[model samples]
Target: MILLDAGTTYAKILNTETNEKTVKKVAELEKTFKADIGTGHNINRFAKQSVNEIIALSYAGKRLIKEKSFTLLDVGSRDAKYVIFENGNFIHSDWNTECGAFTGQAIEILGSYLNLNYNAIEPQKEFITATCGLLGMGHVFDMVASSVEPGIAAARLIKGVCMSMYRFARKPHKIYLTGGLVNNALFVKSMPVETICLDRFTLLEGVLEYAASKKDDINL
Candidate 1:
């Protein structure tokens, strides 16, 4: 199946059969690749069959975890989401909109600022405390000015962001961590509660499930 996540910043395409994933800029995708199944900011514009992101994640998360009740914390580009799954049923969900503090994009920007790759981050302590992404960046700059090592500054900034996200979530029994940040070793290491780090394709998996459920109704 061809699944596309037309996210605000970067767009991703997943080919399930080949188990291959590709990432490209939204602008680049706009001029190319018609989506068979799509979810994200401009789904209505790009998708032949558009699916709601939350509904998709709900179905997708269930498909992965099966009849076990769990919570899903998805930290995406512009927003972060908290989804509750009660034995594979979609029960409750909430998201962050008023601030960028809960976003994984913040981590991306942090990596650029400190020149420390997220994937390369080793286990470290939570030092930075700024909740907002931009604010955390400001703090990073201040630390650099104070002659603190860039690596340490970046790790602390990431910790602050991850911990802030944890504070936003209502802790449940089981937790699955989804989004770009899951690829980061240190952030995953610092999570207070043990979480299953899912691939970035979590939402795409949901879209595919949504499409299958609607196969008879939708033309696509």
Candidate 2:
């Protein structure tokens, strides 16, 4: 079985049989998948193709495992998400409504300007006081020009985001962090509990696992 987790910036494909995953630009997959090409925007186009692929695979007699007991946390360019799973199926999800300094886009943009890698940001030492994305960037720039190290600034930014997600999660369970931001070591380390960084393939693996597990019941 194959699982695909399509996000705003990239797509993750997992081959369950070999437990190997591949990451690629959503646009690249569109040609082979031949699904709705949507607008030129990769995020929208990729997301649409991902959904279509999942549905098509299911209809092709593939067994997909969809577990509901797990919680899936996807942090992306636009927003962050907290999803609950039950019996290999998605039960509910919550997302940040307004754009803020804690968003992935804000982090990446600021990180680039500061010449800081996302993984290099250390959260334990720095304090981030900004309430929104714009203010956050402004504050970061101010610090940067004043000779503050970019690593510290990145840490503060990551800390703020982790705090935001922590507030949204109520139950204590293992969290699976997905999306491009997961590559950051500082951000992953800052997680309150042990976080499972599945790089880009987590969603794909989840989808494939769910599909495979349900084969007997759904005739997939």
Candidate 3:
């Protein structure tokens, strides 16, 4: 079986037969390999079967984690999404970029500006108010210009983003963090509840399942 995650920035192809995975530009659709299932935004462009991102995420989460109920947080490059799963079924799913908060892109840009290195910063009292990435970026510059330490500014900004996510998600008790920020220490610190970080292949796992379902339907 083969699975393809054709995303906007890059496409990830996995050959389940050989356990081989490769990442390439979205435009590199040169029939490199045949896929049994396809997912992500660009899946319809080339994939034989298309799966929604949220559906794939939910399915993958249920299979990998033992928890029957929890909030799945996906902090992506441009936006953040969360899905509530109960009894291995998706209950609620939502995506947001309100005030430019809960986005990995903003955090990355902010970190670069502040010159942050760690996954999470040490405990600090400072907290940024601006949730919008662009606005928060301006706030960082102003804070640094006013003599606030770079690291402190970074921590404050990161914490602010986390707060936005928590509040918007309705302060869930359990959370499973995924997406690119899953490995970031700063992101882990900002969460109020403990989170289990899953591998990046979580969504692909769901795609594989979806492909199997299609095959079963057609008796292939």
Among these predictions, the greatest lDDT belongs to 1
- Name the best candidate (by TM-score): 1
C-alpha RMSD in Å of predicted model 3 compared with the true structure? 3.2
Model 3 residue 217 CA deviation in Å: 5.6
User: Is candidate 2 or 3 superior in lDDT?
Assistant: 3
TM-score against native, each model:
0.88, 0.67, 0.81
- Please provide, for model 1 over 76-152, each residue's C-alpha lDDT reduced to its tens digit, 9 standing for 90 to 100: 77777777877656688987774664446767776775678666666557567775777877888898889987777
Q: Weakest 10 consecutive residues, lDDT, candidate 1?
A: 97-106
Cα distance off (Å), candidate 1, residue 31 = 1.3
TM-score of candidate 2 relative to the true fold: 0.67
Computed on alpha carbons, the lDDT of every model, listed in order, comes to 0.76, 0.58, 0.72
lDDT of 1: 0.76
Cα error, residue 74 of model 3, in Å, equals 0.8
RMSD of each: 2.2, 5.9, 3.2
Candidate 2 residue spans exceeding 4 A from truth: 1-3, 15-20, 27-70, 85-92, 129-134, 171-174, 209-220
lDDT per residue (tens digit) for residues 46-91 in model 3: 6766788887877777777788888877776666778887876778
Model 2 lDDT tens row, 1-220? 4455555556666555787767776656855453221111243434333333223222221222233366656676666666665666546667664655247777777777767766544566456756676787777777778887767766776777777666665444666666677887777887766577655554444444444555564332
